[model samples]
Target chain A: MSEQLTGADILIRALEHEDVEIIFGVPGGAILRAYDSLYDSSIRHVLARHEQGGGHMAAGYAHATGRVGVTFATSGPGATNLITPLADAYMDSIPVVAITGQVGSRSIGLDAFQEAHTWGISMPATKHNYLVTQVDEIASTIREAFHIASTGRPGPVLVDITKDALIGKAPWRGPGQLDLPGYKPSVKGHPRQVTSAIEMILGSQRPVLYAGGGIIRAGASEELLAFATQQNLPVVTTLMARGAIPDSNPLTLGMSGMHGTYTASTAMQRSDLLVTIGARFDDRVTGDPALFAPEAKVIHVDVDPAEIGKIRNADIPIVGDAKAVLGQLIEAGERALEGAPAPERSEWFSTIAAWQRDFPLAYDQQPDRPILQQYVIDELSKRTDADTIVIAGVGQHQMWASQFWGFEKPNTWINSGGLGTMGFAVPAAIGAQAGMPDTTVIAIDGDGCFQMTFQELITAAVEKIPVKIAVMNNANLGMVRQWQKIFYDNRYSATELSSSIPNIVMLAEALGCAGLRAESPEEVVPTIEKALAINDRPVVMEFVCDPDAMVFPMIKAGGSNDEILMGPEDL
Target chain B: MQHVISVTVENKPGVLARVSSMFARRDFNIHSLTVGPTEDPKRSRMTVVVDGPEMEQIVKQLYKLIHTLKVVEHVPGEAVEREIMLVRVNAEAQRRGEILDAATIFEAKAVDVGAQTITFEVVGEPSRLADFLEIMKTYGIVSLVKSGRIVLAKDTKSATKKQRKSA
Candidate 1:
């Protein structure tokens, strides 16, 4: 049945058909018509303090739930504000659909009020975008936008509609056909490639499974665990793939990269075969491309064909969905090893075990002294459940959380890995908490990162989202300060944050949330317990940590993984 | 090395701007670019000549664009190419006869003849047009315009036959 409807109504109907439960945005002049239509619908709207916050919130929702996140904004400033999160989603391969309201078509180039060339600005950042000038095209455009955003190698997509288009009337039919002929993505792995990969896996003496975010994105953590266990291979998860495999597993090496574990990097450097699944060999992961995994022959499996051999040459490149490829690999392995015992690798296991024991992740702590940042994270990890979602901001605190948190399942660790955007924790935590209302959500943020987007705590309090926030108050830009101390002749230039900083506890109280402070080691446990006890509103717990703490086991930029700086002794 | 790339994109507003902006952002210099409607009404063809060492990367990146339907690199021997040039030169009656003689030699057509100048149109290889323009420059050239190179791949049968003969 066809009925007369405005473009705004058509857009809302399309979103409803797609089962979009919530939208994070702030309404403005150009989008007022859509907001009016939104009021008459059943979907919940989350008002963010800033457009960037809304965009990050949408990203968090998508990252946690594996669903297409939706956000709306006005044309000029609103669209510009969305650039950071768009770039963030693009770099991290998150699926997000952003809708913006542009000035009427007639006044697009006349320098009208709040007019911007949104489609042009978003071209490089978005996977795809559309500009709708007709009312009848709204439904199909929305359908296509969702399809493109959530498909293979998902990323952000934008759709900008002119105000005249929104106000215009048309007969509302259901979402029409998506007629995009040039946008097909491959989903099944080639049989010959799968056979070759299995042969390599079975023949190697020293093999390491380098799992990446694609495993989590493909929701194939079970298959990965089965395959790794079946092959008796050691697994190293990258920063974005932290929770893809349980850290408690005997074969797991925490993270491999700039601040990765000594065992993981050494394993990568010494292994004969490095099978990479769903993870790009980023500069942070592969410190020096020529020297990284020098003895390893790579087998890369990813859904995007362009990612294969982009940085490192793949001996066996499989372009297919991670889940499908992993399934095929498992079946092929079972057939190849039929009625045969698994190869014994006691020698390889002992070597890796020695590395793990000799250079375990450790930090010094003294009783009755200033609190250590690592201690705070350790305690939080101890107190939280295995299914708790831990989100962090960028910089030193991000590294600490990634190291200290014991992730046991996928979708439990979320952070800004690719773009390294600070101020991502509070709003992202709120979004994650909203998406998974029954699960506990925690944001571990640094004092520097917290100062960037802490205003979103107001939204959390008003919306009654109970998320626990832990601020590791180091009172300085810890990472940059450490770098200056080491490489810049110990000249502390512009890294300190102790000058005229606001009191965080009072700030949180002012924002209508319960705030607690822990200055000593004794207060850490009680404060965290109290914060965890709150169920009606959000709670912020501030831990005054030592400013001199540094992330160790560091591979300096442009340095090989073999030249790892373990600590001050090495320096 | 200089490489010519042809791109097919959906016929929509601002696509040309998008393509140019991509080149500008990547800092890839475009030696010449010509865009026009193709036989398919919904799509347009663009011919771009670029000077770079990363032509493979450029082709891959261009294909990543959502609106871009197809991209192909035009090899010199496997493709037929042409360029059109229109030149208006100073011709004051006595020089008109000499200019007409040069035009005839170059297989050019006299399109317009004003009181003091004459316009001639020529179509040929880019090198030939450049040589003709050089000769016309000596006759006191007034204005000139050169359409960038346009290309079409030869039929598949002939291309394969040539490859077999080379092999």
Candidate 2:
């Protein structure tokens, strides 16, 4: 029953065993053998214009489906190009497996043609990496790569196989056993720590649940909701944890951080107890670590033990999976409530409500001028379904989308949060569309970010992904421009992208997709309606937005959240 | 304070780079790092001495690495720490006797001797080796090679003795 197979065949078979439906990559000389085998395999391949796009597509697919995303590349520049996506996935804790072909084993260190130290270059960016010189180890290596990538605090894993190994013959064993001796992850919280956290939750008069990306990664949104609802605590989701609790939920205080809602940030700042679940206290969220949650006794629960006190110290640290820990907390909370009544915090809610009313998310609208970028996002959010998958690139547009989009379900909102990578939207949206064919995927990208990786739109058009891309054409790097204006005494430097810009609609049409443009406020709804109606192929909608529209409630870098400026007037 | 952390990791390629790079990325200065194979062929042990304000976070971060199996922070007084150094001193005929005397007093071994140089091997705590090297420098040292510190926790009972008694 043993069939002799090439190393490439073994790799394809291992991917099939892992139930990988598609792979995104660009083949090179080193990876020809693997591509040859892929031609006869059932797994579909999406040819990307660049290796970074392929890597991001895989990440997008993984985020959308909660499955390990797969990509392939060759050595040298090909492998190097995948670094950004690997780092992006690492920062955001997305599960991605990138396979690269190395030079022949003998010439690995001889400075041969197209030879780069893929293993060394990828070490810091990947969760783990493997360099296989033996053909027999292909299946096991691929299996281990996927396993390591998709496990606790999932991140990218890279497998670099020598070209000789890919072409060599080996006995087909059908997925060998993974012999990892030192990789054990704890998934359950200790009973004592869970009990202690529950006691703190019960004793506090004002408690806020700060949720992060770990909620979506652990599939613990339902548990988070149940715990929040039962305890009657306010929930503030971080940028990565936007959909952990529905924005429409009465207890939801919206996103909390630098660009977070005033009410949410105030609640975190004023709370007596801060119960953080699956969220790291990133610099963006904690503007100044000294001033972040200064009045609160923290209870940090994350799957990764390292995140507990990496920034702000936690009073109670529980190292376990978010879902399992949340379930335990819920059980403890219910039992505690049965024994004693829930603590009353009416004054805290009233205070938060006052802040919400006093300092709301606002944008000045000019009826006679061009559209505001935030207004376009708000309109899109109002028009789209609750289940729509909203993907965004970095910068002002990304923050605007996060502020405007009403996320009702987990996994419906995807963005490069930790890395803040630009040009992540279009390819990621394509990957999401490919993963969930029936669902609508929208990429809200800035003009600057869009131009970075916009070549991938050709893949979507050719693959018929039907993803909708809304380009907020502000004709400038809005975020950097805002920074220059505020901090540099209005010195606008290289942030301008208006000079010699290509027509976005014409470019989309040239790439074989339907193109539409909205120049005024009146044209916005019709352009969006037309784009949404076209489901056969991808559509690009360009909205010429005001270049001066800046994201507000700004907490300057290294400044405390307490010193947030409401708008340009505050400057 | 400087802390010595012994990390056990899978003997896989790029693992050493992963560990060292993490220290560099986190801005933690590594005073010394010694890595070698363990009794288990598939595993390697790394003794890393890092000077930093927060060693607990470094230990926890090491545990998060997939290739890292176990990390143990050795208490300063409870662990037996040693470093090995090979020094080739410019031992002229006149200074040869003086060099030998210094080596003997420090309990060092003369591994090689030449017409103009004598290479001595010394094993002791890092501070002791530094002192020995400083004395050798007065003799005009030719070359020096030092193995970064390696440590073993002092166990209350020896497993070998217990196994022997049972047998």
Candidate 3:
């Protein structure tokens, strides 16, 4: 009545049950059995350079495909390495599954070789975790892991299977009736809460819709658009929620954050009512928690109950999946708007349009002056259509890209937002390119952030993914140096870089990629054009810029939203 | 509204912090808490009393926390609960049997017997258990150990599959 199966067999079968198409992972000694079983399964395995890279790769793939991305690692360092990525995914609320191989059940706790307390370490990062000692429990554990990872307010789940469980022969029952007594993911919205939110929106004169990533993940974008159009309400998206409404849609205001479009940010600030869907109010998006949406009565809707009023007060909090909740709201809106005239907000719309015209994000780079990072990103964005995916590394370059490089959609701009993980860009771009092979992948990296994982150039070349990389070579940790200059009275202190890296052009050539350098504004557009023309292999363009540049309009940590610091304003 | 509930759980990673954070983020007021390993090394239990304005909100949060597998059961102490409190009282050697008789009357078992001290293990619902310990206070209580409040449904088997089936 039982089939002879290793723990790996059960794991793969569990993943198959969850309809996972691909998994990203790196093999290690303790985890070889899982790889062996994976060799036979239909699921595609992407071999990444490091376990952390594997984690980001999985996250990028998940973000792109809207399915939970799965990854595996060996015990000890392998498990520890995946921790940062797990934390990043958790903060961003992306669904992922990280399966780590553990030391054999017998060798655990003896200070065994390559043994780390993975379950304990990843406890805070994962939505849930399982340490399987018994081989018979593997299938159920994995089944539960997927259920937890993809359920209410999806997040990363870790399953640490011991080596014995992976190698040992067991009768796999094929994930039979998983009954975890305490785990329940709510799939439906509270009827009363949803009705109240819809009522408030209907009653308001100046109402705005703030959509987040949850809309896309819930597959509710169409519902959102229908509701917005029917009600004739303007919609704004968080950076993560970008493609929920197409940027070209007249009702859509690009993105709302620190560098969010003036129209969207102003509208959010002035609206009588704001309906937040599937978006956590990240600090970057909400400049100061207390002052954010001060004039607006907030209606926060999300799948996770804990997120409601965690930072900001919610006048009406609807707990449910965004799509389900939106569906209900749309139905209510349809019923209410029958033969009714649309509410007028002509004056408010005119005021917001005026702000957009006056404060449009524009920097005129002198054609004769040395190239700036902003100029490079602007040129790249101008040449490329909105279809390109732009992944950024942490530093001044990342800030510049966020401020200047226009993103028409979410998942198109991938970066570690809350965790501020550096060395994220290249691997993330690699993963994004892998996920969407037809789309152009661009990694906007600083000189400092590029060196963190530049070795991944080999990954791009090997995978034959023609990703375009624009390196803003400022020769310093520019963002830190900017803080030092402004806050620490110009004490540079460990921020400067005197050493030279392999001239990026030569490095790109060595890695079998087309290398180009742009040191002037005129060269910026031409370089991007030249690089995009030759798409057979990957290309890396190095743009040299002033090392002392800073991202403008920055509200320092612990500073008020009104106290924004534009560059050189102190001077 | 305030409710004091104890939960029996499997000692595992992130369980305590997760439960605590859930309460903190939900703005639930936690009045008192005590957590320790149980008689079974494989399991740990926690007793938490939360005071908040809304009873339903607190219960919903508790339900969510209880859904984590580490949490075996969370039940209100006033409803159906037990605390096995061990009290070591200083008793004259001659009066040991009398104390034993008292322990028998209280339905307590003698866990430790000594020359001048008699220790009794009392397991009952919280109120009865507290009465037994209060009586022991008259005997010059030397020390006491309590298993906090390990709770169960008044009708355990019935509630497990009945009310919680959808959960």
Most lDDT-accurate candidate? 2
Q: Tell me which of candidates 1 and 2 scores higher on lDDT.
A: 2
Score residue A298 of candidate 3 by CA lDDT.
89
The runs of at least 3 residues in candidate 2 whose Cα sits more than 4 Å from the true structure, single-residue gaps closed, are A339-341, B88-100, B111-119, B134-143, B157-167
TM-score, every prediction? 0.93, 0.96, 0.85
lDDT of 2: 0.90
lDDT of each: 0.87, 0.90, 0.77
- In the range A357-407, model 2's lDDT, one tens digit per residue, is 899887866778889988888888888898899999999999989998889
Candidate 2: which pairs clash? Answer: none
Report per-candidate TM-score of chain A alone: 0.98, 0.99, 0.93
On residues B1-119, what C-alpha lDDT tens digit does candidate 1 reach at each position? 78887888888777887788878866788998999999999999999999988665566556556667777787777877789999999999988898899899899999999999999
Ranking by TM-score: 2, 1, 3
Worst 10 residues of 3 chain B by lDDT: B158-167
Better of 1 and 3 by lDDT: 1
lDDT of 3: 0.77
Error of 3 at A290 (Å): 3.2
- What tens-digit string does per-residue lDDT give for candidate 1 at A1-571? 4689999988899999999999999888888889989999999999988988899889999989999989999999999898888888888888999999999999988988998989989988888888999999999999999988988788999999999999998987888569676566667788899999989988898999999999998999999998898778899999999999899999899998899999998899899999999999999889999999998999999887667777898999888888999999988888988957567688989999999999999987686878988889999999989999999999888998999899999999999999999899998898888899999999999888888899989988988888889998888888888889788988889888972367888988998789999999999999999999998889999999888878988999878999888887888
Instruction: Please report, as a residue range, the 10-residue window in candidate 3 chain A with the lowest summed lDDT.
Output: A558-567
